[model samples]
Target: MQPENVRQASYRGVEDPQRLYLAMLQDGEHDAREWLSTQLRRTASMADDLPDDPAQLESWAANHAAQVATDHTRYLTRRHQGAPRHYFANRAHALWFLQQVAPTKVVDGAWLHGVLRHWRDFRFHGLIRTFLEELGDGDPRCNHVLIYQRLLSRLGCDQGLPLDPSRYLQGVVQLALGRHAEHFLPEVIGYNLGYEQPPLHLLITTHELAELGIDAHYFQLHVTIDNAACGHARRALQSLRLLMPGQCAKAFYDRVRQGYRLNDLGIDTPSMIVSFDLEDELLAALQRKRPYGQFMHSDRCRLQGRTINQWLADAEAMPGFLRALEAQQWVRRGEAPSHSRFWTLIDGPQAAMFGVFTAYEKQLLHDWIVGDTAAEDCRRVRPGQWERDLALEQDAPVAQGEVCVDRMIERMWGNRHATPNGLRATRDFIHATGLTRAGPN
Candidate 1:
């Protein structure tokens, strides 16, 4: 027999637009790919046309670089002149948006890493520099993704967004496609150029978020790190020149345009902002669960003169279900009802339906049921507060000798010149040291 949770509901049936887009790509859906390629070409045409002469092409890039810097300064000045409308209403609102896009955050660089691995035999210096930066100097803690994770934790959103492919937008999946399609080097580079060039959006986002008292480190990090003047954008252009010096320049540039165009293919930040309707989102979540629960055994649970299955089956029955839950004293309509059974089943550690809903889903339900209209109360931390907090969490009391030994182990693991046997010895030494602890594995 299926587990009660499995029998009652499944997250598998939920529809995700992003997932469908990816599936079409994987299946070699011709029409879809052509449509995407055409769209990319169209978007690229709006920018400067590629030059036939390689030297002229190089000059064009230099000119584009100058324009980008000028544009950045102009936009920053405009923002300082008058604060734009806050992109998010409050901290909670901002956190919700971040959590939604979390799955795709900092992921474009990882795809680039895979593409670079394929070209390792050729030894492109610019590509290698870009890849190393993406790797964060071989320190997992400093990796871009990990940095995003730290920000999430600071916001008390460390639980993470669901890994559902559907959660990602189409433009994000295109980055993965560019990387995975190793033969299409120009396209990959193009994607990198478009992705790395610090757009007006990043600058605006960082400023607006800072004004809202929310930590804007992630956006700020990107604004400087991906700057068109001397950062990833410059590196991406340099890499193109290094990899293919005057060979098939026009063809390569054309492909790069297509890759750049992919950035416009899916849901963007503005779309996310415009589509954020809480009641609609809550209703959609319940609807996604409706199919699985429709056939559930009603004998096990009943509410509102109907079985749990019946309550779930009707799209318009949620208000009635809530009323029934309130009638049974299982929910409090206008407060954080931690003691509510319905809440527990949806969110608790030992919940019958644990692992089914995402953090965002649970949050939506909590807000809806509580009728929460309260403003965000989370206090703003300073620029480096999250980093300081992380250091504190990682620091612990230990013997001086043990600390030295741990550092030695880390150094050994990081050494590129260390022999296999030497590395093995370092690992074994750490394991042996662990034997001193009193615990059963």
Candidate 2:
């Protein structure tokens, strides 16, 4: 189901990011000029920590790499000494992080959208290669977005959840940049440069996520492909140098700096990681489930002064109800979840409430119950643990509604994701996009 926020009208928040994202993916125009103008204005007063001279990009990248490498070494040393995870508190936190970042993840490589038309131009080759690679060069197995989608699917996060609109801000900016490339080329180059420089958090996140049993391949891919030595970071600098005009070079650099500052505008990875509160998320999950589960229970059991139904009826009293559960012997917090009577009903094969809560809800409850006592049971889904594209293997044409990626691919290039006639249609369409040296999409 589409999240309510996603289905809202355009211009919702910073001009409704979902609509703008959809418009571009559908091969249609949704003027993001006003949105970009507002963002550009926001960054005008922000600090530009990037080197002033574009010629210094190589050294700037090296400095960044050295710093990240040093920090990662320290992080590993701490981990070796048995420090708790620096990012994820538990497996559930890792899944939550993945789901929360879906908006930005799905729009990977959007900033370089405008440069696709210049595929044949050697000057634009760096940017174009980066963009194509983002699309996995049309390979389904390697497509960044699809890989994330599969991760969510395995973890039961594919179904929409109520997400903060602010989560979409960076994605909206990316799509907007793609649509407004003619006016934002320098900005795109600058933004790409900032994004391609692998931060220390990327390394830490990949390791921690893997420790928690989540496939960190997506992040691991970025760590390697976005390396400063000879990866997208290098390519970003090359594109900036190649595209900078001889006339009014200072003005161009000013714009690039402004664009680089644009990276600071959105809710960043650190903020997202710190924002998670397991208890708060559990409360939300309980509230969502309460609506339907309110009357499902028998009136046989009562906690404190209220019956189960009565407690469930009052949404505003959720916190109190949880406290009541803990106050009684019904739930024992800060222990193995299996020890709690409340967890008993929701767990096991023949438990009365076995089917009442979703796998995600069950996970939330488990983590909340475990609390500070969480042990080393970190693995969630092992890599390639589930089969992908079973229907395609069964010789079935993918259902139209289920083919979101293929639908967009078809709209843009009259080809589906998987190909017939021995042609990798998606790859050919994207690679062959630049009909001329610098043509339009």
Candidate 3:
């Protein structure tokens, strides 16, 4: 069989092979089943598949790398402890194992990670150094792995940025040095995954740093923001020791010095510290959709400092505005099914951030609220919507039609907007009241 076929077939065996193995151990004896339970309990910890140390992770990568082509049987045998090594000599043996029962099931992703880690550990010590000898210039696998590894190392490094060390040290000094193992990294770095967007590099500049007035409290937090774009960084985290700030609190400021920061976290510095403003660019984009100041109701914009809670709490006309704005643009001039009505909303400090929608759509939404045009186009597609439709029986219901937010979020990034969390809460509350069933997402 081809390699791909063998791999697929092996996976089926991997998922289910419990009964046959127990039978083999039992030899059809009644006592064997009881003995198997005890053995099973002993091996329960193996299910965790934790690395013995940093070296073990590397060894795992190397082992899998070697198995990529040669000795498929040995590869399968090595997966289980106490299982005879090299028991399977050919693809047929692997197939037999799959058909037979096994004591435990192997998780697919975890197994893959173990193999990849073995290869990486081998490469780290120059065992397979040829792949990454030149850095940024090598075979595809070598280059990809090397670059990612480098990026992770850079992100993890602590260079001692200009944070106050005294406060950070306070957290460590408070810890009991004798009884507790100190975990310094978690105290310094924070990991969060936002939607799949590129790093906000422009916002990282020191100029922006000046605008975020850094107080002592901020330093004490030792906040490190991780975007998770780099795989090596994620992998290296296997060795990370997590501890309270009471231990090694200084490590937090050290990370700050090394430029450990988050892209999404806003700066607290004074606004005057920023040399350039994005206001012009934002204004230009807004002008393209509507005449400047068309949406301006009063000199004082209602959106400033408003949380997402407040925005969604506005009159029922708000959702209408969203629906209208979403419909103005057609993918092609005259396509059948159009775009989504709910744009992604982001909550910024002063503004409710939403994305590219047309002026006509925005106006139509305002009109829908107070009786300009009855929204007749909204339709329900998923079962959730059907459930939601039924709930709104007391209120007048529209036809079974509305747009899905998935398409908007996935395709054009149309769903992103700057709505405050509070505003989002209010919107969610209102939405919950309607017939729509909550989505699985």
Candidate 4:
């Protein structure tokens, strides 16, 4: 089926990755294939750094691991020398990075879905296990997508920008890889190899996010699970070596190289982290709210000699209006938000304007008012303080009018994985695939 809103809703551009994601899920053979040829061509110029021989993959991974360890040690030394965060300038910046990357994280491990049905093949077990882990084996807490969803919810970053095409590249490539794997198994293997290797940035990001009181379990989870010693990194290499065809090996290796380089197609993490502009983000947030807010406020209150509605009338007035709020003490910049009269008006339920802003808008306003203290001046939680394992409360009460899932069984359905009948079918599939013979992925 299509994603939540593909046919009815229009996204940023005609080639939005979200559409391609569901399109690939729904029908990858024809439509998705037609689009991929143009996109995959761009990966042509990328360097083929992987070894030409499959047998050397483990050795290559070991060397890469050693180099990463050395680089991270150097990074730690610099940090201990009274340096600021290498990735984030502040908590707001960190939050922005998370939001920008949410499109990919929400569809975690989608590239392996195509490999799941190949569980009968022992070589496919590794990839299958990775996919299952991404699903947390049906446990809500461990599921990568669920964890990322919870992280965004906790930070009020659920309403993120989905307009950017770059935001959807990795995610689209992944979901499209169903037999987007069977069609290009070598490329999928190559992509997995590149993705599983833990980077120095992941380690530093995990450390810094915790220092900002952000629950970094999502990044932390990657750090631990992608470990070079015995984790997905090793698994990726092992799987590749075993699965690579013996004859026509050179053509397969060529495809694998192309797949490895595909990981480099989108904006890298470091570049995105350094790109945050607090004022620009704030201005954009205000601009989006301008239309709805333009006529909503009354003339009862005045700021800078104009009524609140008058202050918000012009798009150009947004910046000056912010200045007016600060000048009139409506917003106390660089201080605890509670100390400002404006903060109370939109924060608590008792406040007059609590529902005016969405969670994302409120976060932007909150961070802007709090200013520089959004990161440093805030109290830091010790690492692991907020890293508790989450358990799904199946018996939890649902209040009236709340959204709930009610499954409709269809005997002819395909992979409705969460329902009782679906789960039973999955178990039967697993049994049919001979999991015991395949062993641990």
Which pairs in model 4 have colliding backbones?
Answer: none
Per-candidate RMSD vs. true structure? 12.6, 7.1, 29.4, 7.6
Per-residue accuracy of model 2 over 345-371 as CA lDDT, tens digit each: 889889988788777778888888888
- Candidate 3 lDDT: 0.24
Model 3 lowest lDDT segment of ten: 102-111
Q: Please provide TM-scores, in order, for all candidate models, with all chains considered together.
A: 0.59, 0.85, 0.17, 0.83
Give the top-scoring candidate (lDDT). Answer: 2
Over 4 Å off, model 3: 1-48, 52-59, 62-316, 322-441
- Write model 3 residue lDDT over 205-241, tens digit each, in one string: 2112122221111111111211122232232233232
For 326-389, candidate 1 gives per-residue lDDT tens digits of 8987776676646677788767778887867766567676766666454434455465455544
Model 4 bad stretches (over 4 Å): 1-14, 22-30, 373-441
Highest TM-score scorer: 2
Put the candidates in TM-score order, highest first.
2, 4, 1, 3
User: Candidate 1: where is the Cα deviation over 4 Å?
Assistant: 1-86, 90-92, 114-123, 150-182, 208-214, 285-315, 319-378, 387-441
Q: How would you encode candidate 4's per-residue C-alpha lDDT over 95-140 as one tens digit per residue?
A: 7888888777876776676776465688888877766655655455
